[model samples]
Target chain A: MGRPSAGKSTLASHVEDQLVEAGYPIENLDGDDIRKHLHPDLGFSREDRRTNNRRTAYIAKLLNRNDIPVIVGMITPFRDSQEQARDIIEDEGEFVQIYVKCSVEAAEERDPKGLYQQAREKNIEKFTGVNHPFQEPLNPEIIVDTEAQSIDDCVDDVMTQLETLGVLDERLDDDYSFSITRSEEQDITERLEELGYLEE
Target chain B: MGRPSAGKSTLASHVEDQLVEAGYPIENLDGDDIRKHLHPDLGFSREDRRTNNRRTAYIAKLLNRNDIPVIVGMITPFRDSQEQARDIIEDEGEFVQIYVKCSVEAAEERDPKGLYQQAREKNIEKFTGVNHPFQEPLNPEIIVDTEAQSIDDCVDDVMTQLETLGVLDERLDDDYSFSITRSEEQDITERLEELGYLEE
Candidate 1:
C-alpha cells in the first residue's frame, strides 16, 4: 500500500512476473483491474477508500487460504484502513506491507494518469495527497523510495525483501529478464505510462 | 447452478467439507455468502442476476488459475449467463456444471426462507422461478434430483461425478462424515434450514 502514483502498480506487476517465471504460485491483483472489475462503485472519499482496502484484502485472504500468495497495489491513504487490511489478510497468511515512497512533487511531476493535474487544477474532491491526507505507513515491512530509484530498482528491492522474509526460496532465484536494464526498458516504460499503464 | 431452494447451497457446502477433509485444494463460494459479501447492491432483476453470475465466475477463474478448484452455487437464471460463466472459468480450468434439479412445487413445499410464500402472496417483483424465469441447464456435466433424493445422496452423486471427471484421485477418496446418514444429519439439516441456512 502506498500513495497515489507512488509506483505501486508498476513495481507490483514486475515483481509478480519475476516470481511467476520461477514457478511460484503467485498472483498480481493490479489496481487498475480491481478498479475496473470489482469496486467500480467506490469513490475517493475516506470511507470508500477503507471499503476498497477491506475488499481487496478479503480477496487476498481467499487466495492465501489456497496457498497462493498475492501482490496487491492499492493507494491506501488512511492508517485505519491499512490496519484493517493487515488484520484481514494476516488471518490467512503473512501480510507484508511494502511502502512505495514518492514525494508529492515527484509524483505530480510523473503524473501518469493526469490525476494530479486534475486534482490541482479542477480541485477534485477527496483527492489523496491533494485535498485529502495520505497517512504514512506505521510499520512497513519493506520500503522502496520510488523518487530516488528507477522502476526496476524498486521491483528488485521488493523481490529481495520477499526473499529475506522467506517468502521466496533462494535456490529458485535467477537472472530474471525484468532485472536487466535496457534502453527499451526505460523508453517503453515511459510510453506505457503515457498510455495509462500503471497509472494506479 | 440451480434454481432458488433447489438444495444447491446445502449440497455444495457438504461436498466442500468432504473434499477438504481429504486435503484437496478446493474452495466453496456459497450463494448466500456471495450475496452477503460481494454484491449487496445487486437486486433480483434479470440483468443483476447475470452480473452476479459473471462476477462469481471471474473469482472462480482467479482461483482456478492458481490450481485451486472452486465450487460456486449460484442461481444463474439465464442460459447466456451460464454460458458466459463457463467460458470465463474454462479459460483457466475445467468448468463443471452441476444442476440440482427440484420441481417448483417441491421447492415451494420445502421453502425454508418463506420466499415462496412471499412470492405467491405478496408478489415480490422479479423473484426467480416465480416472476423471473430460471432457464434449465442445456448440458450439465452432472444432474442430481434433490426432490427425489436426500441431501446426502445429492452430495455423493457430485463426488462420484467429480471422480469420474478425473478431478479427484481415487487413492485420496475416503468415507467422509458428511456421507454418513446420522440422525443428526437429517434433524440438524432441517433445523438449520429453518434458521435460514441454505435459503439461497
Candidate 2:
C-alpha cells in the first residue's frame, strides 16, 4: 500500500502477471477496481476507507484460502486499517506489506488520474497525500522507492523480496524484459496508463 | 442459484470440497457470506438484491479470470440479475448455470434457516421463493433436483454435467464418499443445518 500515483498499481500488476505466468492462481486487486465494482457506495472518509480495506482483506483471505494469491494495491492511508487488513489476511495465509514509496511532489508530478491536481484545487475531498494524510507503515515487510527506481526495477525488487521470503520458487523468477532503458520504459508505462491498463 | 433451503450451499460445499481435493484452485461464493463481508449495508430490497447479485457476479468474474473457478450459490431471484451475471462472467470465462431444483414445498418443509416460517409470519420482506418470486432459468447448463436426489447424487450429477460440458477433464473425476444411505445423509444434513452450515 502507498500514496496515490506511487506506482502501486503498476508494480502490483507486473507482479500479478509474473505470478500468473508462473502457473500460480493469482489476481490483482486495485482500490480503483474494488471501488468501481464492490464498494461503489463507499466514500473517501477514514471510516469508509477502513470498511473498504476490511472488505478487500476479507476477499483476499477467501482467495488465499483457495490457493490463490493476490497482489492488492490500495492507498490504505490509515495505520489502523492496514493493521486490520494484515490481521484478517495473515490469519488465513500470508500478508506481506510492501511499501511503494514516493514523495508527494513526485506523485503529483506523475498524476496519472489528475487526482492530485484535483485535490490541490479542492475538487476532491479526502485525497490521500494531498488533502489527507498517508501514514507510512511503521514496519513494512518490503519497501520499494518508486521515486528513485524504475517501475521494472521496483517490480524486480518486490519479486526478489518474495523469493527471499520463499513465497516464490527460484524457477518462478520472472525475466521482466529489462532490456529497455528508463526512458523507453517510462514511454511504455505512460502509453499503458493512458490506455487504462495501469489504473483508472 | 436456487431458492433458500434448496440445498444450494450444501451441494456447493460438497462440489468445492471435491474440486479442492482434486488439487483445483477454486472457492465457494455464497450469498450469505458475501452479504456478511462485502454487502453489509445492503438490505433485502429487490434493488438491493440486484446490486448484491451483480457485485457477486463481478467478483466471480475476477476470480475466474485469475484461473480460479468459483462455485457461487446465491438466491438470484430475478432473471435480469442472472442474465447480468452471465453477461459479465461469460466475457472472461465459462459460465455454466446449475439450477438446483426443488419445489417450494420441499424447501419450506426443510426450512434450514427457518426463513420460510419467518416469511410466512410476515417477519421478513422480499424473501425469495416466499414473498418474492424466483424466476427459473430458461435454459440452465445443469439441473439437480434436491428433493428427489441424495446430496451425493446431486454432487455426482453436477460433476457429470461439468465433465460432459468439457469444463473438467475426465481424469479429474472425483471419487466421493458415498458410504451412507439417504437416511443417514439426511440425519447429517439436519445436524449441519442446525449448526448453520446449510444456510443462515
Candidate 3:
C-alpha cells in the first residue's frame, strides 16, 4: 500500500489480472472502489482511514479463508494497523504485504486527480507524504517502485515473489480459468425476504 | 435495522419475498450475509464497525444509483453515519432507516450466539448495549419493536413505509426485473484488471 497517486490501485489491478491469468483464483479489495460502493458513510479522517483499512482487511481475510487469494489496494499509512491486519489473517503465507513505493515528487508528477496540487494549495488536508506522514514498512515482503518501474516489470516482480513463496502452485497455473454464472434471481428474492430489508 | 436475533434477517427476507411476489425487483444487503462473504476481515472495533457501515451504505447507494431500492439490514448504530448515508444517496426518500428496537433483556433472552452471555461473563468486549453503546435513533422513519411485534407486523411496517416513500411505484411493482444481469464474477475480473491487481 502507498499514498494516493502512488500507483497503488494501478499496481494492484495489474497484479490481480496476472494472478487470474496464471490460474490462481483471486479477489481484489480496492479502497476507493469500496468507498464509492460499500462504505460510503465513512470519511477520509484518521479514524475513517483506520476504519477503512480494517474493513478492507476483513474482506481480504474472508476471501482468503475461502481459499481465494485477495489483493488489497489501499493507502495503509500506519504500521500498527498493518500489523493488526496481519494478526487478523494469520493463515500461513496468506498475508502478503506489497509496498508500492514512490517519492512525493514522483507521485505529484503522476497525480491523476491533481491531488498533489490540491494538497499543495491547501485545498486538501492530511495528504499522505505531504501534510500527513506515511510510515515506511519495516519488513514488507516485496516493494515496487512505481516511478522507476514499468507496469509489466512491476507485475513480473510480484509474480516472481509469489513463485518463490510457493503461492502459485503448478496445478493453479494449469487451471487458470474463470466463469460468469448468473445467480438465480429467485435466490436473491428469497434471501431478501429472509433479511427483512425488503417489503413483503 | 432490527436487533440481533430479533429476526431482522427473517423480516428482511419476508419483505424481499413479498416485493418479488408483487413483481418488484430487489436486493438484500444483510449484515450477517455481508460479514460471511463481502467483508470477512472486519472486526468489532469501532473503526472497523464504521467501515462496515460505510461499505453497506456505499452498496446501497450503488443500488439506488442504478434505480434499485436496496434493503440494508445492519444495526447501523450511529445517527451521524445514517445521516451521512442519506447524503450519499441524495435520491429523495431513497434511504429508509428502520430501527429494529429491542431491550437488552430481550436480546439476552434470545442469545442466538450466546453473545449476551459472553458479554455478561466478560468474555466478550465491545458488546453493543452491554460493554459498548448502541445509540438509538431520535426519529427513525420506521420503528419496529421486535419483542412486541410479530414477523408479519414488522414486514408490513416496512412494506407500508416503502409504499409511502414511493420506492415501489406501480410500474416497478408490476415489473420483474434484474438490475445486475451479468455475473459479478465478470465485473470482479474486469475491476481486477483495471485496478492492476491482476498479474499479467
Candidate achieving the largest TM-score: 2
lDDT of 2 by residue, A1-200 (tens): 99999999989999888677656667788889999888688898888888889889988887877667888999899999889999989988889999999999999999999988888889998889877889999999999999999998988888778867767642233435334333344578899999999985
Q: Which is the leading candidate under DockQ? A: 2
* lDDT of prediction 3: 0.73
DockQ of each candidate, alpha-carbon based:
0.37, 0.44, 0.15
| Second chain TM-score, each model | 0.83, 0.84, 0.79
Q: Which ranking of candidates, highest TM-score first?
A: 2, 1, 3
DockQ, candidate no. 1: 0.37
The positional error of residue A100 in candidate 2, measured at the CA in angstroms, is 1.5
The CAPRI quality class of candidate 3 comes to: incorrect
TM-scores of the models, in the given order? Answer: 0.77, 0.80, 0.51
- When 2 and 3 are scored with TM-score, the better candidate is 2
TM-score of 2: 0.80
Candidate 3 per-residue lDDT, tens place, B1-200, comes to 64566566777889889877765557777888877655677888788777778766765664554445667778666667777777776653366777887888898898888888988899999877788768887777788888998878888887777667665654443442532212233477689999999977
Least well predicted 10-residue stretch by lDDT in candidate 2 chain B: B170-179
Rank by lDDT, highest first. 2, 1, 3
Candidate 2 wrong stretches, greater than 4 Å: A17-25, A170-200, B20-23, B170-200
How well does each candidate reproduce the native contacts, as fnat?
0.45, 0.70, 0.30
Instruction: Looking at model 1, give its docking quality level.
Output: acceptable
